[model samples]
Structures are given as structure tokens and as C-alpha cells.
Target chain A: MSTATFYDQVRTAVTNRVPVALATVVRGTSLGAKVLILPDEVQGRIGDDALTGQITLDARSLLRDERSETRPYELNGEPIEIFIESFPPPPLLVIFGAVHVAQPLSRLGKQLGFRVVVTDARSPLATAERFPDADEIIVAWPDDALTQIDIAPTTFIAILTHDPKFDEPALSGALTTEARYIGAVGSRKTNEDRRERLRAAGVDEAHLERLHAPIGLNIGGETPEEMAISILAEMIAVRHGRPGGQLSNAEGSIRGQVTSPVG
Target chain B: MNEWLPEIDQWRARGDQVALATVVKVEGSAPRPVGARMAVSSSGELAGSVSGGCVETDVFTAAQEVLASNEPKLLRYGITDEMAWDVGLACGGTIEVFVEPLSEPPGEKDRAR
Candidate 1:
């Protein structure tokens, strides 16, 4: 395929929020050649059929891991190197309240490369002017909005609607999804009462365990921006499977365990 | 790379040759992540970056050469005491950047997607 067509496929996959990988023969006789690999199909050609097949498999593996790396291979006794670059769609951050904290939280989410969506029932509160950083504004009930959007493992849901009428259904809807992180904002007693209400409403204990009520790391943050940072901290910790504790008290690598070659 | 789409399209629209430099592999504490990209135009204009202020000048020169030669080049940059005054990442990390010329875009209509 022509390079323009190859790039078009890559761009289309990325715009559609699909995981895609591009393998380039960076240090080979076929240098500048590329192959585009999606989950179900492959396009372009890095080299001959055998080499292209190998790169396609490797590209799929790297795409699944959301990693980019350079790997060395041998073609007819000659060393060849290929760079496999994976492009996973940006993670989704859904904020279910356009409150004071949501403003800074959405901004932080965008700064961190998340696609932020803010949803609220009150049209006046969920205006685009209030959330300049949010990629989407849904003026609908929090639970209804949650059900309407696509929530996958790459999604993080924050229920800031503290009222029972909203937070209850919001929590229920969030728990039903495969979202990686589901956090809610409330006081300790408020969370406890919220849990009781959820339990009475048939939300099982297993699902209740998934709720991060009284959300955010205990950073002693009182202002809206600081609270936003604390919430994002907790979300990041959850993303990396960390305990969200003080690094000074923690052992092992400050970056956590280096499990992959890319690190 | 998606972040540089508009700039790349503009360069192509202006009939300027474009070379894309991407950090394919990173070792140790690099400033940018693996997929970080920088685009250089034939007129010497640049957008995005593959490193901190440590090595863009060299990458720019290499990009111009790649654009002229129509060949892909893989470059490595790192810090060493011997090369302290040279172009190297001050963060003491190694990064492999691949520079290659991008073909002219299909057309403005195709770019809207």
C-alpha cells in the first residue's frame, strides 16, 4: 500500500477509538516500510510475507499491552530491527456532577490526556462555559447518562452528585459497568448511609466493595483544586494498582515494579 | 502523532516535504514517553518534540537529512560525561528515534476524516 493509504488506516483506527499498532522496519533493508495492525486485520507490508507475518503477530501483542518498543529480528542472516508503536484510545473520565470540584477535576483529566465527560441533570449547571475542558457535556440524569455512554475497562467514573436521589442511581449505574475506577464524593457517615441504602436496594456486597466512597487520597486538601488533585491521585493509584500511600513510607521502586520491557 | 495531524496536514497543503521523528524506544528515565513525536518541514519549521530541550537541534538536522535522502534513520541519544557538552539527553536516559519522510497527503477532502 502507499504510505498515504497506510497512514489513513492508522488515522481512521485512532479516530474511531480502536486499538491499533504500526510496525516500521527501522533498521532493515526494507527501512521505511510499515504495516498497520488492528485487532482483526492487518494492512500494508513491512517486508516479504514471512517477515510481515511475524511483525503482525508482535504488533498485536504490543497493542494488547498498550506499549511501544523496538525488537530485533534476523532475516537471512542479516539483523533487522522493527519498531512497533501501539496507539490505544485515550482513557475516558466521566464526571457525574458539574460542581465546584468537577471544574478543576475535568481540567486535570484533560491535562493528563483523558477524554473527560461531564453529566448532570441540571442544564444550567452543566453548561459548556462552566467546563471548558470537558470533551462532552451531557445534560441528563447521572444514571441515565452513564447507561447511554460506552463504559469499558478504560473508563473511570466519579459520582460527585452527593444527593441520594442522584448519587444512588449513579453509583448503581457505575457499578454495573466494567469501569476500572468508580469513586464517589461524600463524608464518612454519608458514605456509610449511602452504602446502607445501596445494600437495601439489592446492590450486593461484592459490588459495594467496588465503590470508592469518600473518595480521594487523604492529602488534607480542602479547596476545590486541591480536592481535584486528591481525587485524581486516587484515580491514578487505582489505575496503577497502588495503595495511594506516602512514597516515603513505601518500599520497592518508586515507579512500582518494572513488569514490561518498555519500562 | 494525532496531536500533530493538523500541522502535518498544513505542511502538506503548503507543498512542503515533511519528516516525522518518533521516539520508538526509551530506556531509563527519559523525558518523553515512547510514542512522543516531532515533525519537521522542509522549510525548517518544527512541531512537537521527542525530547526535552536536550537533543531537538540534532534531531532537526537529522530530520532534514532524512527528508533529503528519502531514507529512514534510527538515532540514539543519551548522556555521558564525555559527551556532556554534546547533544544528549541530560536526564541520563537512552532513546531511539526513527525519522522518516511522510508521503504527501491524499487531499484536503480525505484529511477531514
Candidate 2:
């Protein structure tokens, strides 16, 4: 889209769930211009075909992950004097339960700028009225809801369908996808029990470890919101490769912004 | 830039001439990312940010020159291993920034046609 309406339309499209891409001149002679691109056409310009063609190709790759960045290139179709910065909104968070904890977890996730989707098999529990703050609340099985959308590495998946029958297929589907985080809510005994079931179901040990089964840092959380905080904390820890344990149990300096929430 | 549309539009509706600067790259632990950007108007109004804060002053200075000369320039800052340490990031990050003056198209003064 042209620079004029690019922000308005993109903001509305993103807040309304329409996929889009943004290409901007991040460097070179034409440093401050931009265009918005959907799957079909464009809303802005970067001179002409040679530069636009190259940037369109790059925009396609970033489109899948909905990423934003500064990418440099040449200008006048021959000299290097242009940069295309792409913005594709933010990725999504698909949670497979509307349990007591899902409320705060989804709330906190929204605060961090994630488009949260809370799903459940029970209609009463999955109503939008219950999750007034979530981006979407679907009253459907996890697999059915997930089948309708493509998953990205920026996506986060949670299996709070405490029951084994629901959590199994739910966990199975999430593990097979490219989501950056896959966590399940449970306990030590519950973790061992689930591991046995997943192993029996042909899941390998390596893949199974990827599942954060007790699903949170050891914060001794005793309530839904507290547990949500611990789970979010552990998710943060995993994203940055920090040890997910009590401060007394960890080592080395903690690094980077505490609120990045990126995986 | 489209990135500043929300702020730029608000400023433009009030008759502003905006200048822009973008951080194209970082050689070390720079606070801002490669695509970071900031915009300024002829009347000293500003929006967005390239560095979290440390390098914006330098960018503003460069933007003033771009506005005066109407010429884009690639300026480099933050050299490590220098005891003089002028205009360098304390975090020891090196950065490259491009500053330019944004102008209206021909026959499009009143409206950005």
C-alpha cells in the first residue's frame, strides 16, 4: 500500500486477521519511501520493476513468518541505492484450551502483542464472552481449528486440554508443526504418565523432550495466574536458552531485554 | 516512510515537511536493529526512533544536514578500541545510518498526489 494509507489499512487488516506485507526503503538514496503488498498487487512503489521485483521476492519469504526488517539493495535498476524493510504484522498464539489458566496466559500473551486464539471442545468454555480479550475463541476440537491455518516458527502452542484423549492428538499435531514453543500443562507424575503414552504412540525421546510437560518454571505457583506466570517465564527462558529453574539453581549472567518474548 | 504513516499523516494534515533517517546496519552490539528508522519535520517535530536513544542525536544532526543540502549521506559512527570515544556507543556497537529529506512531488504541493 502507498505510504499514506499503508499504516491504516495494515493496522486494520492485522487487527482484523487479513494477511499482508509491507516493503520500505530502509537505506540508500530513497531511504524513507515504502509500499504495501498483498498476495496480488502492491500499494506502494520502490522506483520500478528491477528493484520492485527483487523486493517482491524477499517480501514473499518474509510473508510466511510475518517478519519485519531492513534489507538493502541497488537503485536506478543498476546501482545499489535502495533498501526494502518488510513488515508482516506479528505471528499468532494458538492455545488448545480455555481452562482457568488459559485466561491469564492468553491475557499476558496479548499484552506481549500476540494474536491469541483459545480453543476448546466444550462450547460453553470456549465462548468469546469468556475470553473477552483473546483475539479469537473457537468452540471446536484443536485439530479441526488448527487445520484451517498454517503454522509459523513464531507461533506458540499450548495443550491445556488436561485430559489425555484431547491433549494427545493436540500435542501430536503441535509437535509435527513448526511452532517455536510447544508446552503442555501437567505435573511430575502427569509428565511421566504422558511420556509413556507418547512413547507408546511412536514419539521419539528427543521430540518428547521438546514438550515442556509440567509446563512452567519451578516457581511453586499455587494458583491459575501464578502458574500462568511461571509457564510464560519458562517459555521466555526456552526462547533465550536460559536455564528454566529457581535463581539459586541457575548460573551465568541473564542477557537481553526481559520483554522481548520472541522465540 | 510508510512506517511513520500514523504520525506522519497526523503531522502532514497540519502542513509539515518531514525528513527521515534509517539505520541500515550495525557492526556490533548496537541498540537498534538494521531497519530502525526515525522521522523529523521542518519545524523540529519528530516521530519513531532508530537507536533506542543513544544514536538519535547523531541521526538528528545528520538529518539537519540532509535537509539543508537535500542530499542523502551514508554516515558511520561508534568505532571500538578508541580511547577518544567521541560520538561512539558505550556498548561498543558500530552503526551505519542513511539520512534524507522527504519532499513533495512536482504539482503536488497542497496534496501528496
Candidate 3:
């Protein structure tokens, strides 16, 4: 693509949360040289080897944050500059149940910037008509769906499936990888049953503890939508390492409490 | 730079002189980190921000001077407790801003018509 078009597309990509990088020659030879790169390949370039090499490294680093800038490098005795921007798409929310709670929970997940994916064995309950907000409505079995794809830290799991047959396998699929948050929508009795099933399947107790059974914060929310709000709030709190308790009830620094610090 | 482009282009398209003030350095708990920017138009209009409303007005003033002088300048705005309340840094941090006037805004002359 032309430089301008590539620049425009890269800009849109960042705005849309699509990962992208731009390479510019900030110093040395071809000081004003430039290029653009996505995850797959180069869309544009700075016209030299050293400059492209320097920018490619910078691009790899930009995948983590909302914005970042790197130091300048020289290309063949010439200064080169490049900026790789990440407009990474929102993380995926994989909900493995078509229960009553999943309806509003999935809707709330979308508002919280998650790309909602609802999957279940039952078709009638998890149809497009019932969930207009869900980006994907998969009628496949949760285990089957999960094994078919990789779940990165950016992916979140909500096992509202409740039934052990669906629930245990989903937990196995999730615990097998590094999905950021794993929560289950169920009652105390339901959670106890889940723990037993998980133990029977050889998932250790410590791993079982990672399950946020009786999912969501103790906000005393009873309704499905309110429950959804609390659940997502808890997920966000876990993701940011924030205290799940109310700030008013807490003491000491709102930051650096309990959790270690990292940028 | 890309975030401020819309306002920058609007001002530049109007043949309005502009000054770009960017925070290149900050010490301690600054309201704005390094690279935070603000664009000031000759009409005294502003686009974007460089602080938590702590020193933007002064930065805008510096930006005006950069526009008038047609030269790039670096300025220090010390805001820490070391500086009294009169210095505008009640938040107790300092920010150094670089103001540059853009006479040849990329792809300007051709678009001016």
C-alpha cells in the first residue's frame, strides 16, 4: 500500500484495538524515512536494513501498551526513527454456558470492552435472537470449542454452565492454559459439587482454588444483570491487582497493597 | 502527535500559525508524563493537554511566544514544593516543555489551496 494509505490504515487499526506498528527514521541516514508493520508482515518501510531492523524490534515491544516510544537508532551511518502503535482489539470473553445469568453477564461483558463469545451444547437458549450482544454464539460443546483454539491471557472464561459434565471439562480446558480470569456462575452447593468433580478429574486443589466459584464480588447482587456487574468488577479487580473490597472500608495505600507492583 | 493531528490540521488549514509544546521531561509526581503535548493556535485556541490543569495556561503562553519568535525553545516549569504555590505546581512536580513552531507542516502548501 502507499505510505499515506498505510499510515491511515495503521491509525484506524490502533483506534479499533487492532495491533499495528509504524516505523519512522528518526535519525542518521534517511532521517525522515518511514515504514509500517502489522503482526504478519511489512506494510511500509524506512528504505534501509538497519532502520527496518531497529523499528521491527520496537514494533514487537509496542504490543503491550496503549502507547510507547523507543530510542532512535542509526542505519548505515544514518539516523532512523519508527513508532509502533498498538490499538489491540479488546480481549475475548468466552462464556461456556447458556444459562439465565449468561444472558445479562454476556451483555455486561461487552460494555466492559470484552469481545463476548457465548458457547453451549444447547441451541435454543443460546441463539442469536436471545443474545444480540454476543459476538459469537457457538452451539458446540465447550470442551470441543476450547480444545480447538488457544486461550491466551487476554481471554477470560465464565463457566456459568453449572452442570458438572459441561463445567468440569471447561475448567480442565481453562486450567490447562493461562487464561487471565476463570470464574463460574453457581451457588455454594453448586461450587462444592464442581470442586469434587474437578478433584476426581486430577486437577489439584490449588488449581481448583483459582476458580472464582460463586463468581463475582460480594456486592450482595441478586439479579442477573447486577450479578454480571459484580462479576466483571471482580474480573477487572483481579486483572489490575486491585483490592476487591470497597475503598472506604480499606486502610493503607490504595496502591501497593497485598499485590506486588509492576508497570 | 497522531492524537493531536485533527486539531493541528484544522488550525494549519486555516493558515493559522501554531506552536507545539511537548513535555520532554518530568520530575516526581507530575500531572503529565514526558511526551504529553498541547497545540496552541494563533487564535489562542488550544487542542490537547499537557497536565492535570496545573500548568497548561503557562504552557499556552510559552507557545504563543514560540509562534511570535518563529523559533524552537525549551522551557522549564518547576512545580514541586521546592517551588512556592505562586509557581503553579501545587502538585509538587516539575515539567520541562519544548515548544516548536511548524512553518512547513507536512503536506501543507499543496493542501492550503
Top DockQ model: 1
lDDT of 3 at A125: 82
DockQ of 1: 0.44
Cα lDDT tens digits, model 1, A86-148, are: 888888999998898999999998887788999999889999999999999999987679778
Per-model TM-score on C-alpha atoms:
0.87, 0.68, 0.63
Predicted structure with the largest lDDT when compared to the true one: 1
Superposition-based RMSD of candidate 1 using all C-alpha atoms, in angstroms: 3.5
- After TM-score superposition, what is the CA distance of residue A176 in candidate 1 from its true location, in Å? 3.1
Question: Candidate 3: what lDDT?
Answer: 0.70
Model 1 DockQ class: acceptable
- What is candidate 3's CA lDDT for residue A171? 86
lDDT of 2 by residue, B15-76 (tens): 76666677766665677666567887767777788766876777887777777776667778
What is the TM-score (0 to 1) of chain A in model 1?
0.90
lDDT per residue, candidate 2, A1-263, as tens digits?
Answer: 22335555766766665667766565555655666777677776788777687778887776664444556577765444444445455557788888999988888877766778898888888877778879878777777877865688767787888898788888877887888789898878997998898889998877887788778888888888898888778767766667666656654433333333211
- Candidate 3, DockQ score (0 to 1): 0.11
- A best-first ranking of the candidates according to their TM-score comes to 1, 2, 3
Better of 2 and 3 by lDDT: 2
